[model samples]
Target: MGRKVCQQDHGQSRQNSNGHSNDHLFSTHVQAVIVQLSRPVLRPGFRPDARLWRGGIEGNFEVTISMYDASVGLFVPYLRNLSALLDKGVAYAEARKFNPAVLLGMRMAPDMYDLAQQIGEACRHATVAAALLADREPVALPVLEHDMAGLQARIATSIEFIESLPRAEINAAAERNVFFRLKNGTELPFTGRTLLLTFSVPQFFFHVTTAYDLLRHAGVELVKKDYLGRR
Candidate 1:
């Protein structure tokens, strides 16, 4: 008798003339095959459901990489720019024989956080976001970076912590549950991806941008590129 072919939805399986399963046969013949027949089958961690993305699957690990990109590539660099701007501001203050601390308290409005607090909060958001998503231990708590040097140090510490985190550890956190506390002591729950996009990223940008605005308002020689860290 001739060989027979059998197929299943979204995949194919074959049987030989002797009725043996083709799994080993096909594996030997083909170096690689992607059987998207089920959910949670991909490597680099669990597979995503094809149904979740209109027949496309984005594994949790990949999403974590995206978060890392945004957090590190964008967030940390902006903070570096802020630090450079602060250096310029300090020089200007000293040249005029003025107290640099006056600029630390400067804010767009009296009700909002001052520049020092904004820098601290910005660093807090960056480091905390990395920790929360990676399920890693926090390196530092939020502090009042009330001076340019202090704020710069805080930002540098955040960068170091973020850089030290392993990519696999962050991606593995997909299965872990994360939580954040709000101003009124309310703890909001989150999944790794959810926490990164919905909360951490937004909070990070808000504080960073506020710090930039405070500097701009105080007449620091800053351009859009300075705030964006493109230069």
Candidate 2:
């Protein structure tokens, strides 16, 4: 039953006899738990205490991924990978007996942001997207330094902030409209889903890829696995 529901890519929910739609309860990444609710029928906003399970109905439930699973789930893992890439940078610089700051200041183009700024921007995109979805204020980032500790701290702070958001709030914000403000006072608008899928996720990856490219160009000895991270 769980395997069949998990294989459904449409993510559509089935209406129960009591007219409750278990939309939010199902997730593609199903845990190995079976729960049966018999007394009271499923209703709207009714969530099981478990994180996300794939059992209950005899065979009617459909598995669907949540908004939080799509957005924050993607950000947190890649952010950790970014931090590990920085660690490799520090190690490479130490072995070469040169200042790691040189690598941080490296950029692919003269007109582009340097490595430190690239890291900062990546962190910003992730945190900002998570905050907007969760309906909370993003953490005020300090000026980033072109040093190993400063770069690592920025990544750590970003990971902490995004991980601290309430999952339910982010899930509820799926269709909410969000505004992205630029430095020149231009505000771009997007619905929560569009914000993650189009704007923020792409922006985050661009900065992170730029940072990795800068480090690699400076001889940091990173492999493809370093960027993809461990499963």
Candidate 3:
């Protein structure tokens, strides 16, 4: 007798060689498995079906991570940590007998955005991505205020907006098409997943990290934990 493995087909089950029904296997989650056998059962152009599986003898399995988990799960914490990070900037300014607003003008390079702009971009990326995925208009950028409190308020507004989006709507947008328009009036097209993963998240983090670096370079004391927050 040949060794038999379980396969799922539209919720129906068949018995294996051991006379046990295989319906229970992979019934609970989305997964892809590549079994290691004498012969490769995964053929060329093999794709995950409705069940998200390709079967053969003993193989490897892949799990589907959700879009919601990838997007909001990341943006919220980092935005919160970003807010906390700015608070440290305020403290550093106070202790050194300088205006906290001074730090917002610091940047690593002359061509780059200063600390205030970086924070604004970070908040913009987070909120825009969430709004796009939720099928809503993104929050408009307010007039740039030169104060630390103003920047902090921007972060607060972003957090509130991102948290207000429905998780289900965002999750369902994984395959939806969205266009990103650049300042030059060029529109770039992307699916929701690609927009968030490839563009939005990366852009968001770049500005956030730049903001952190600006403060550190300006003599504000910050550790990695300040960036990561309580994990």
lDDT of 3 at 230: 81
lDDT tens readout by residue for model 2, 1-231: 555454443345555333434343444323333434322346877756542333334235544456777777788889999999998998998999998888888888899999999998999899989999999999888888878898898899998899888877888887999998776999899999998889999999999888888888887899988999987
- Residue lDDT tens for model 3, 126-159: 9888998999998776888878888888998888
Q: How does model 2 score by TM-score?
A: 0.76
Candidate 1 per-residue lDDT over residues 137-200, each given as its tens digit: 7677556647667777787888788777765456455556888776689999988778777888
Superposed on all Cα atoms, the candidates' RMSDs to the truth, in angstroms, are: 13.5, 8.9, 10.6
Give all TM-scores, in the order shown. Answer: 0.68, 0.76, 0.73
Among residues 3 or more apart in sequence or in different chains, the pairs in candidate 1 whose N, CA or C atoms overlap within 3 Å are: none
* Worst lDDT 10-window in candidate 3: 29-38
Minimum summed lDDT over a 10-residue window in model 1 is located at 55-64
Ranking by lDDT: 2, 3, 1
Clashes of each: 0, 0, 5
Per-residue error for 44 in candidate 3, Å, reads 35
| Candidate 2 or 1, higher TM-score | 2
What candidate 1 gets wrong by more than 4 Å, as runs, is 1-65
Predicted structure 3: clash tally: 5
The 0-to-1 C-alpha lDDT of every candidate, in the order given, reads 0.68, 0.80, 0.77
